[model samples]
Target: MQKLHKLLRMGDLAAFVGIVDDGGFAEAARRRGMSASTLSRSVTRLEEQLKVTLLRRTTRSIEITSEGAAVLAEAREILNRSETLKEIATSGQAPAGPLRVNAPVPFVLHVLAPRLAEFHANYPAIQLSIDMTDTLVDLIGSHADVAIRLGRLQDSEMLHRPIGRTAWKLVAAPDYLDRKGWPEALADLARLEQVRFAAPDHINTLRFIGMADPLEIPASVTANNGEAVRQLVLRGLGVARFSDFMIADDIRAGRLVELFSGQLDAEPLEISALYLTRVSGLRRLGVFLDWLDAIQVG
Candidate 1:
């Protein structure tokens, strides 16, 4: 055990990582300006220490074994943490670390996609890892730095900062309306073919403004992705309630027509940036939240 402990040193692990990253011993050695024989030996030592075969080698090419692939993932995380630690120590004023974010698919597709370049330009030092999904995730349990959520949130220990809201737009393709006829009221929505977005967390519900009760309707088709739902809507498949931001271009282009504008305001789709209580104190989180708060959702 002690021998194994001595062999799994940071330097040896780093050397092992380089081998996998560069794809082969000779290439990694060339990049690092080290002897190929030295790197090969380091990997050999790592394999022995772990008591697993990490590589399959012949005269010409080598492939990583299953065990090697597993270790490679862990090694990369270690290296990333090491890099973050070094950056944090050297650059105190600049927020430099991996910022893992989770956000709804609709927001990611319509809102965040266009402004990512600007965000990167502003925070070039901070590494962003954005996970797009509609399903609700535990921010603390998932080790995510921030989660951009829409609609109401259940009481939780995480800190929430209001960012923006999504204004719901009831819309359909012009062709669809011509074929199925325009929905004059919320009651008419049920008669038209509906493009449904079903996810574990998203309720099959739409609440309009000035309506006493939310409309409950069954959908003709279901889709998991917001982009897919938009496409489905554009194809004249059915009428679907969409965030105004997602359909703004279509509406302006005369491709889609908004219906029931005077009849309903969607139950507030409040957008907020949720983060762990512990992470709220971190400057990296603060920097990201500040940026989020400044976002003007069009």
Candidate 2:
């Protein structure tokens, strides 16, 4: 409205967005084919108009102020909507420039992070910006090109393509299993050591194939994150369960052992690659989704 116009007047929204997204006036200017001083002035004008500081200046890094972070998210949303409008007006065209993606932390760390080199090598023109978190992201609100979602999905405007699936892999480091021994049966958990995160719902107990009841396993140590749990297992702490996606590499490398040799069922998890529209897919988004679909784990 009037205040928004006042806040963003004169300077293009793209300038401020470029500065925030690239993390500095210099990088933004470099990318936009403009001088750093120009982008600096653009940001300064924006701050003056908005009456708030957006960034903390330093030689090493430019940190976003709290207000700046909030505004940055909004600015990305605005830019995204503007892009969508332009695409609709012209018909969806060839994709270029940055392609923002959001995915769970574990997926990013284990699956996406390791293979990023291949992605870049294949599609060097598409700049990949990744947001790694377990939380679900609103595609339009976050201005993300795509999102990798796991488990049951709710009805939404976004189109989801089934990308991959993960099943439970009860894993332990070779040394740990050798020393502490593996949980031979579901009932053996009362005496075996286990590592788990504090996620009450996921690790409250272990569910097995053809088991009517969930078995509550006592944990030797509880960490706060999936990576932590994975690390503890690698460090020979205890036998713990992981989604095959999270422990695939380790299991492949013989760093960890999948416990259920012939006892468990492979109930793979349904993972989807989500995007806003299907009628006219962005070329880069389609390319990335195909690349993602080929990722092997469990």
Candidate 3:
């Protein structure tokens, strides 16, 4: 029983599921980062231990036997229950694992960075690795422990906790507004020079509160970097739409002024802390989520 338990690691079960999911040894091997022969050997070893043929292989395809199908279902259930048990067991212990996290560049700099010292002081045993980028990462494939995401999520498999909210604001340097004059209505936006952020191609079609319908703003300048946009706005070049958190300090310091404060829609973007359901219940992740929720940033 001890030997049998030693052989049944999660990686082996994952490989088995991969093979069954991909419908062939080669595809499963690719997904699992192993060669087809290696995956076949592992499966063969597993079958030998159980004294049962799990797969019927042909030149063109491979199929799970009735027994194999039953085993697969049981394996999945066992893995789920095992993970749950591990989470519960570790919840009361000090967090002492490597945690890989991802978030947008602006959010990391403005919101998270300021609070890292406190988190580190509280949980010195946990190691943190953060990737700051605008691109969404595949949490499972990337092995990310956690991610901070804005807006609605299309993937339903991830467990999400709402952390906070931020409103999008049209902002410009006080000096720039002094020269160009503030626009009275949405129609005036077309006449003014604007800086736009790097967004999906379809974003241009969506209408903001002031606009009657979708209207494309003249991209007098376009930047993939959020910091560059903020700098340009600070230099009195043009008005840019930015999340409130990004320009909060500037607004407070009188470096930038909010445009159309009352007339704009003031849509609040929902910020969420997301992780795979499998990873969400881990001790380190749970603590971080609680910490994130406790933080109050403007």
lDDT of 3 by residue, 237-287 (tens): 788777789999899999998877755554577888888655455677778
Which residue pairs show backbone clashes in model 3?
A: none
Model 2 spans > 4 angstroms off: 1-95, 140-143, 277-281
Span of 10 residues, lowest total lDDT, candidate 1:
1-10
Off by over 4 Å in 1: 1-92, 183-191, 200-218, 277-280
TM-score of 2: 0.69
lDDT of 2 by residue, 79-128 (tens): 55566565566444444567889887898898888899998988787789
Considering summed lDDT, which 10 consecutive residues are worst modelled in model 3?
A: 200-209
Candidate 1 lDDT by residue in tens digits, 150-230: 777786556788887767787889898888777766788877877887663243466777677777665768888777888
Candidate 3 residues lying further than 4 Å off, grouped into runs, are: 1-5, 8-92, 182-191, 201-211, 214-217, 278-280
**Model 3: how far is 260 from its true place, Å?**
0.8
**TM-score of each prediction:** 0.64, 0.69, 0.69
Clashing pairs in 2: none
The order by descending lDDT is 3, 1, 2
